[model samples]
Target: MASALNSKIHAPGNCPGSKADARGGAGWRMDCDPEMHVKMCKKIAQLTKVIYALNTRQDETEAGMEALREAHQEELQQAVAETEARLLQAQGRVGEEEALRQRIQALESALELQKQLTQEALAQSASCRLETQERELRVEAEHAERVLTLSKEMLELKADYEKRLRHLSGHEAPRWDRLTKEGPEPKAEPGCGPEMREVLLEVERLRAENQQLSKDYARKAEELQATYERENEAVRQAMQQSVSEALWQWQEKETDLRKNFQAQEAALQAQVRKLEGDLEHRGRKISDLKKYAQKLKDRIQDLDVQLKEARQENSELKSTAKKLGEKLAIAKDKLMLQECHVTQKTGDMKTERVSENEVLRKENNLEACSLHPQQDQNFAKECPCTKGGTDTQTKKEACIETEYMKQKYEEDLRKIKHQTEEEKKHLKDQLMKRLEDLVKKHTVEIKSVRSSVEAERKRLQKEVEAQLEEVKKKSENEIKQLEEEKAALSVKLQNSLLEVLRLEEFIQQNKACPPRGDEKPQELDYQHCNILETQ
Candidate 1:
């Protein structure tokens, strides 16, 4: 009994005995013989040892379950944190996409504005071209009208001079025929014979003077006709030169304007083409970005699915942990009941000892205690419960790895987005620079064209002015020459008319004389002498 007491005190099961002592009392009395008491003590010690071993196994199971729960909880928290971070990154990417969309809209609006400006400029150029055409037509019409007027004036002058020449020829023909037909006068009465002879001589002299006057008139008329024709030709040539110069200037101006307009149109078309190309490039980039965003969304959805699966797995693990804890509690309760039954049995069997049977029972119980550890080992191996912590750790690692992949993907997407933005900026800058250069080049060309046109116009105007002055001077000189010729012809006509009147007066003064044969002979001699003097 002393040995049994010492064993009981030293056994690992003594921890439960404190509760048992509290329930039963500090000391208990047993009504049994010494041998039965010793046997009961031995059985009690063996049962306590078995109970202690079972308790230790239950504690190890509980500790493993707790660790698994902690590991699973940690893994679940990490998954949740990673998911939140990915969601935040996704939202940031969405914001960047929205900003890119707004920039595209602004670019489209700017392109539209540029198109409108180009159209307006084209319309203005077309209107200006139409106006120039109308002005040219008007000038041509005015020039035609002036030419017609000049031609009509020339025709009228030619008809008037022809009529005057015809009338003068008709009058001179009758006068010449009458003068040639006159012969010697008929014999007159003796008293009027001398007067008649004197009148005949004087009439002959007047006819000769009239013939000279007609020849002078014919020469003057021929000269006047030649001068008029020359002046008309000169006037016509000058008018033609002026008209041709004006037409040529207009043609040059029209051609230059057309060239400028064509060049501008070509430049505008090139600019439009460049803008179109840029727009297409931007559209392609936007499409790529959209595709990338869609890919990101798909990845995010995959992550969400993974997260859900992880959450489901965590819930399943929690349920399993709860089941294990419940099973451990039931086992502990059974062990406690068994310990109670064993204590009751020990109290009852203390006075009825069968030594050999008790010894055998102790051996069996010792063997059961020894076998309990093996059962625990087998359970730990086969149950899959103890591996929960390792599984949770693996799942946590997977979750961390997925989070890192997600972060990498996000970083890659951000890099691509930034690269695309930089490319867009570079393209825009190049386009602006090209457009600015084209504008400056076109402006310089326009300035040079304008200056050349102005200089040409001034030179043409000077040439036209000089030609007009020369024409005026030539016409004035011709008119002055004609006036001088006309004045000389009139002076000669006046002197011939005075000489004819003096011969008529001399014939009248000799009309009173009568003549005999001798007087007649004297008269003939005097007439012959007068004819010789006149000749």
Candidate 2:
């Protein structure tokens, strides 16, 4: 019987009584005993159960693998999101740095412009001062020239008067000698006495006029010199005051500009340092995020490896089940042959065979109940056949136990798949939320930074405008003062010219009328002399 069973199990498809041929024949019929038919039906039922369990296990494993794939996809998405966020942050920091650099350049340009303006103003002031000084010196030189000319004319007039006086004295002595020799004869001439008296009166008057003229010329010259000196002193004082005030104003402006430049430079340096620090901090954060992403990638790789292994195991189980199915088909063919033989021998043994099958089924149920679920599956795999049992019974029991194991495996796989799906969903949601929050926070920070920069720029502009206004006011005041000083100097110059003209007119009038000794001097000439003496 064992040899027959072996031949049936290993039979080729082309053999006449082979399992394949039996299943293929359209008119094939079994003339089998009832007890043997029952046993074969039980084996068929067990094989079907095993196939159903394997299909269920395969579905569960596929589901579990799908869950693992989703989880890996979610991890990859999260990594991509984090990388994009880091890139955005880096770009923002770079933009901020560029803006700061532009602002610094603008400030530097403004400072340079201010310096140029200050320099131009100083040059204008200096030129104006030099021009004023030159004008004053010219006026002084003119006054000195007028004074010297007047002094030379006065000296020439004094020498002429002295020579005329000596001539008059010599002629008078000769006339007196002649009058003594011919006194009686001269008494006989008409009007001689009266004429002599008149001559004497005129000489006395001329002498008095000459003395008065000398005194008036000396006094006028002294007055002219005094006025010229006083004017020069006043002009000198004004020039000194203007120079001193200009120096003081220029000093004050320089000091203020220096202080402002230093303050602006310090502020710019601080802002640059702050921006650099922020860049460094951002770089560190990006590096840390990159490391975290790498770790996630490694974990995803491990999950992929596990999923491949699970798929490979599921395929192996399917192949083993296929082999078991082929064995069960061969066993069914052998059981059919044995049933035909028993039926030919007798029909009276039917009740006994049915009772025996029932008792064997009951014992199988009891054994299954007594074993733990895991142990039952392990026992079935390790010991498919018992020493006292027939080969068909052993195979049938092994198929049933294998089906139970497959069912358990499917249940475990289904549970694992459910858990993995939940975890994947939860992780995806968390990563998305975190990314959203980070984006919002970065946006808010960028807005605040922009506002601060604008405010600082406005403040700097206001300060520069105010300083320019102050400098303009000061320059205007200085120009006004200089103009006033120039006007005063012009007025003084006009007055000095008028005084010099008056002195020249007086000297010319004295030269036009001179006193005579022979004829009596006119009364008008005497009055003019008296007026000149008083002046």
Candidate 3:
């Protein structure tokens, strides 16, 4: 049993006992019957073989089945993987289709939206055009209204102006008074005015545009326009009214002012006329005075010339008187000489008479001598005489002697007396005749010389008077002309003063106020300006 136990233990299939290789002996001693052991070993071997076969078969079948399961699992995995990949591909295709559909839908939606937007834009543009047209109409209406209002106002103003003009036709004190002259002259408008119609048209246009907008829209769109319209109208009306009122007042005042100015100008013109007349009268008076002065000067010159002539005449007369005196002296001397000659001739005649007488006496004496030649008369002569003869003879002798002596004495005395008487008579006759002739000749010559000298003096005096009169007239006329020129200059200076005052008033209109003085501005050129060109 032990061996069976060992054999069984050593057996490959089933073992009951100890194992073969355990104790060691057959190489450990067959511990059981050998045949039995052999049979057992054989049976064990058979069983081992059968077990090996069966195990091999079972292992192979398990391997095959495992391989098949693995293959099937692999197949299943491949199928599952293929299905998953196909399903994923299908899902991807579906997603791609969905994405494409979304893109197409988006494009269609965008096109529809674009069409709608175009339609909306057209509608909005039409609405805006309508609104703009409405605004234009409203603006035109406002402009018409403004024009009508302005026309009405102008008509009223014209009517008022005509009424005032008619009222001015009635009589006042003198149409104007002097007190108005002391007031200021009215001024023209300050600056050059623009066309009122143009400004009104612009304002109407803006107002129309403003009215076109809705109140809410105006707040958004025409806020500036609305404000401008209100302000423009207010300013226009205020300024227009101010200008119109000023114009009205000015027009009303202008009539009286014009009348006053006309009156003042008329008075001034009258004064100027009077002054001119006075000036003319003065000039005439001066001319007459100059003429009278000329006459006086002429008279004085004539007197002077006459005086000089008289002086010359006096000298000539003195010379004539001297000549006459000399002639008288010469006549007197000639008369004296003639008297002497007459006296000498008379004496010579007397001497001749005396000689004749002496001749007679000499004859008588000769006769006596003849008779008494030889007679000696001392004694009485004894003669044969008759008695009468002797006595007569004696007496005759005595008488002869005595008569001779007496005759001689008488001749001498007569001769002397005769010369003296002849001289006296001749002197008296010659003196009287010479005096008469000399007086007559001298009177004629002096009268002729005096007349000629007086005539020459008168002619020279007349020429000198004419020259003096011309000089005096010229001097008087120059003085009168100078006076007239001075008067004219004074009038011109007054005109200049008026012109300066007007100019000052005009300039002061631009200033803060007017100055009351006649001051003027002055400028001085301190530098000598020259332009020199150099080439």
Give the best candidate by TM-score: 2
Model 2 over residues 1-535: C-alpha lDDT tens digits?
Answer: 3335434433444233434334422112233223333444555565567667878888888898898889888988888897888789778878987898798678768767866766665675567566655656565556645554554555556556767677776767676677778774676447577767765786887778787766666566556645755665566556556655665665566566656655665675566456546645654564466457546654765676567667765775576567555655654554444433332222223334446556755765787898778866765564434422443543354355445544654464466458646855775686567557755765675566556655655665566557556645654664465456445544544454454445445444544543233111232234334434433
Tell me which of candidates 1 and 3 scores higher on TM-score.
1
lDDT of 3 by residue, 74-143 (tens): 7557656866775686677568657755764675465456446544543553464345335434543554
Deviating ranges (above 4 Å) for candidate 3: 1-253, 366-535
TM-score of each: 0.33, 0.45, 0.24
Worst lDDT 10-window in candidate 1: 25-34
Location of the lowest summed lDDT over 10 successive residues in candidate 3:
526-535
Q: Worst lDDT window (10 residues) for model 2? A: 24-33
lDDT of 1 by residue, 1-535 (tens): 3464534443445344444542332123132123433543554455456445545655655565566557556756765686677568668757865775575466545545644654454455445444544543454344334434433444454455456557655646664465457644434468856754665565566556555544554454344334433543453344345444444554454455446445544554554455445445544544455454444444455445444544544454455445544643453344344434444444333323335346645765676577777765664464355345544553355345434543653464466448646855775686567557755765675566556655655665566457446645654564465356445534643443454344345334334442232243344345435534543
In candidate 2, list every pair of residues with a backbone clash.
Answer: none
Rank all candidate structures by their lDDT, best first, as comma-separated numbers.
2, 1, 3
